[model samples]
Target: MNVQSKYSILVFNRENELFLPLTEFYYYQQKRINESSALSYLITLERFFSWLAKSSNYQGTRVKWSDSHMAIRTAVENYLIYQMGCKLRSKENFQYVIMTKKSPQTINHFLAAIKSFYKTALHLKLYEFQNPLVDADYSISIGSFSPTSIRENKPRLPKIAGTEIPSDSSYRSQSDSYFKLVANDWKPNIIADHDLPYIIYRAGSEIGWSLRDEVVIRMLFETGARINEILELTLGDYRQRINQYEIATLNKGSEKRRIKFLRFSQDTLKLLMRYVNGERKTYAHEKQTFTKLSDSEVIFLTRRGDPYNYNAFYSQWSKIITQAKIKMNIHKTRHWFVTNMIRNIYDTASDGGEIEMKKNELINYMKWKDPETIKVYEHYFNEALFREIHENMAKKMQEYEKEYLKKSHSSSEGEQLSSSVLQTKAILPTEEIEWINEFYKGME
Candidate 1:
């Protein structure tokens, strides 16, 4: 027999089956699967192979390329069951090994891959056994769904603990004090130059990341775009719309939408434009490869000029977060931006007693649907403003009372009314108090 035929026969014999070239079939199957899915299959197969190599059935000898088909199939089935049992016990903390959640989709995928392998072996005449993965029964009750079902049926709302009105002033004071404490406690040891974008870019570069990494980070922080959405961005996704940048792209699940970036993010946008126009354009021109440079080309690229993969970005981000000594994940930068922006909006509204047209336009541009979504910021704003107003009014009233007492030795009815008005306005709005009193027919 020729070298190719001999090698094929040996490969078939190793699995103890007859009639198939497993490696060739695997290559064909891989071509049908996406890169991500193919990688998952390869990982699973490696684990299975490792277990098989360590099994006592092999008798400390390597299984020949031409192994007994029935024996190989039985061994594989036993290994699968053992793995499932182990996984179930591990997930349930050993409390009940038989009552662990086993995903049908995962098991089905494993079975499918193994069945495909056996089919290929049979086609090549390398093995004579029936597909064991398909024949084996995997219908075992791993666990109860009671906990998950209960969680799904539970109501979603914050439970209020007390009847007392939560003073806006008190809330603001507490929030400010808490943020100040946290910020002070976790201050970075290495003082970064506050040149903003330049500092951020250099920090990213220091960690061996490309210019694209800096752009992605800035976009996440400034626009609050989810990480997956940022990865999906293409060169043509961004467009200049008057003073701001509008990014039209698909989100995680391929949901297409538009998001507007404020003028404050201009510097970051400019850097991205520079990188694309200067570096990206030049590289594509020099390479002159079959792939044409277009807006459809991925926005982010690796050092080698290839498209940036999500997994690679995540690994790098974890390391960077650790190095930076950030108490939260990188995604917290997005939360910080959203929270601060809402706080600013609330402050402006409280100061003016109404939302300005310009401020309203900006809020709309950000695509927030409900005013209540910004209520957290309002809570903080109300608390701070109320406290300040009350403290100032109280001090003024104390002065007025002292002056009146010195002149007349007692306050008149009018003086008492004025004092009452000041104190009443300090706590609740005049209109709200009057409405309440009217509704109650003068009840205290």
Candidate 2:
């Protein structure tokens, strides 16, 4: 990756100069999409621009943001080809290798960014020529029906297939399917609800636990929110009296922003209060000691009191899972939350119309415009199915525990395992709740 590429895409040049074209394009995007989504599009543009700087066949050694239409067009095509794992026939192309491959969904995102960039450029009269991506292009087609994974018992979305298009004078004219890239065979990992308490217990453990990290974990599990949405939370957005936090997250595939309210459980609320009043304040003071402080109202902060970025939060989560010895991603918690919420909100024993009403309510809560998206979790639609799956999961978890113990016994040195890792029901005790109540009472 180019050093300049790491910077925000809003920086149009290596000299940190702003290019009016991209600035105008970004503002145009902001009008239609959320700020984060707009910024992501710009970030994609940055990556493409960085690749153009090094790639051969462009007229100049240095490609400016305001390069000619043909140059930019050719670069866009070549970049897509390169991302699809084709070698570029250029002298300077030897500087790079196809070690890492991009998924179809990722390439589609790149395509979207480039297309949007040129579209905006044309709209703003920055580019007089036709849009580069006006020709036939690659798009991922996730079919109507998804197949269930026998191993995980969850839906695995089908791979991306090329959209059959009539040949024309523009790009991808000949056998566009020949340039097929494998799409993401995405399988939603669902964490069993029985194991959730143990995960939360480990997250909030006294040893090596960061209260901020714990709060974020608990919030994700409880709210079924995307990590970015949760990270966007601020002190101003939080309503302590209502035990809710409101966030305006970008809804996928649309121009609208979804306003979501994350209602916290009583335990999570207590932990959040403790973090805000105690550890976070210390972090803020430490940050002030090193540098001039600004009145940033962002809720979750690093030890240095800087607001949590994705990479920093991911690193913290990595540490959390490593200590907990779990083979699950942070995203699995969302699946768990969503499935459980569905189970709770819609009882199968209820009338048919009531089910539809509850489903509509869930769709509204999740801020989903399309009802079909909820079909992915269709397996957990009923109480009977949920119970069966839960029972099977409990058995599987026991077998996994036994296998884990057997491996531990065979290790060079036998160490006693933490109950938070080995046990499924490691919830907080009555006295601990009493202690939390008393502690907050004194603070009040």
Candidate 3:
């Protein structure tokens, strides 16, 4: 097997069989798509090949070079079984081992990688036998009486000009709900409204984190920006626009264009400036490792003053959130941003125009080309939104009643120490007010 890779990528032929070509394809696709996504496709294919080699060995047989139709099918079945935490005898180690099943999202991604490989293999005529991954509309079998035979005799399906890859629902919704769970479980009572400040204090004070690390935490929670976008920023990128400080970085999408953030807090701006004008100056000058590394120039630097590694940054971030008792993925920050923004519209009882205006602002703020995809955030934490609105409405009603009762007294409080004042409110409750209270009770 000839394995070649520049980064952590694994592109190799297995026992002289070129079941996939990922290097060139990955590179080609990276230019057209996100680099992270391209790398994931390559890694998934590598794992699939490993599974195929192991599966073949488990059955006491070697994979054939020519007729891999059965091999592909069997390999996939074994891989799926293995993913379900089944005990399987490894051909490589010759010992029974537990095969840990991946998430539904990961499994689907792996399937896509295999499907794409087969599609390419068939197009290039890499093998004489049929590609098992072909759609049911096509035939890849030769003279035989079976489902395979039917496809063989049937005409091949026309290839579409373009294509590509949902299952994160259960996994993600759990975290979304956790973020909206508020402080019933929190010792300090960190609800949705106060989560930002609560976390900021913990990250900066309890952890005593470095300016760079603290800034990263702030950027994640405050702006809900992607890690890549934050890592791509520089000292020069932070610009002043009138009274506000905005940072323009490339947003996540096909276009990958820069978008300006106009909603960062003044304290966050000060911390960022402190890091840039103070510590960053001393730190940036001390870095001497990996002279050609892009991290050397990137704004968020490691203790060694090099650029942040994605895995390292993520691992450390997850640790921080866990230590702080924030029970969710960092991506919840993005969800928090959208979810709270929606809640704010109702908090102020905004009109159609104001509500629609905020949505438009969000479209530009998040760099969303299609507003439709952004609507998904609206649905997240919907139950929590309902609870919050209900609670606030109930409070407002109580305040209205107190205010009405206060008219019968000289004080704001109902502490006139007289039954006549209380009788005044009791005797003059409006029919409309009674109806409204009744409606609220029904809503509750």
Candidate 4:
């Protein structure tokens, strides 16, 4: 039999041995319109089965048909707790790991994924008993003294001239206003125009542009979605409306929500359209796609016309940012859009009443549940925009000091070395003591 047929047989055998009704559930998932999501669910369930078989807690004990639910739940909960602990300890070694520093969102995603798996396992009668894992509460302790302790333990680097000072307030204000302008300008345009986004794409392509990069940048700018939300978009998730686009899906924490894009540029829509029609369609025809690709049939494709992975997407985005002369990080682009939008709202509102009116107007306009979210973009308006100015100043000062030292040393070499050197050294004063002598103190 072929590899796929052999694999299917193995999976079937395992399913039967485990007494899991996984095949039917898998079929149900594949039948959903959002097949990508169905596939992810299946893959997660498959992992659950694999973990159940290998788990020390589950080994040798035959899962009674009635105890299946309890067995699966207990297995999943134990696995999640073990994984979370492993992640926390691994943080010291893998500092760049994104979720190393836990956030509410990160913890929630982890819990939700495990919770969903147990719920599905229970439904499928994978075990004989109700899932014990379901009864466990997800809790994390953020130590009260942790932040201050960490700060104390961390080594501080000497301040260098060119490095920008880390001022959170200033950065936030600037970023908030930058994107508002871009979004409002494109609000009146058709999404199919394809000019603006293409210009951005081409300009950014020196680093590299994949189909997903094009779609992501466009979506962020057009829809004002967060980077995580943009990354989550799949082909089946977006719906075109009369004047806007509606993205209906689960966000980071599996919370289903709808976000509306009022004025998607025609350019962005056309690029996405072309990617779906040309790139993704061709990949599906070739049948060389990965499991994720086959399941999602997403709009954005890799150069090989497969579904885009996060690492590859980030690498490409970093390259684009460098090529485009954009001094901001990838997430900064999202900030750029939001900041500009808020600024425009602030500017267009009536005088004196501007802040109050604009705040209320944006609440309705953007459907923001909390006005405090707007504070993230406030820095752009508060300061001047300059690149490497402080760094340059620092370098120049260091150079001047070096040149002065060189000149002083050269002059000293021409005279009686010890006396002249000491005199010349005194020309450029420093706080450090020149010499220490027990007997010479009174004479000096």
Which candidate wins on lDDT?
A: 2
> Against the hidden reference, what TM-scores do the models get?
0.41, 0.47, 0.54, 0.40
Q: Kindly indicate the candidate among 1 and 3 with the higher TM-score.
A: 3
- The candidate that wins on TM-score is 3
Candidate 1 TM-score, C-alpha based: 0.41
Cα lDDT tens digits for candidate 3, 189-271: 11365466466458556666677777777777678676677877754455424445577676653345555553577888888
Q: Which RMSD values do the candidates have, in order?
A: 17.1, 17.4, 13.5, 16.4
lDDT, model 2, position 268: 86
lDDT of 4 at 36: 37
Per model, state how many residue pairs clash. 26, 0, 3, 41
Estimate, for each residue in 240-269, the C-alpha lDDT of model 4 and write its tens digit: 344434554443223345453334577777
Question: Model 1 over residues 15-113: C-alpha lDDT tens digits?
Answer: 565423445654545555333344345445555655666662544454432466545654554554566432222221111112124422244335445
Tell me the RMSD of model 3 versus the true structure. Answer: 13.5
The CA lDDT of each predicted structure is 0.50, 0.59, 0.55, 0.47
Predicted structure 4: clash tally: 41
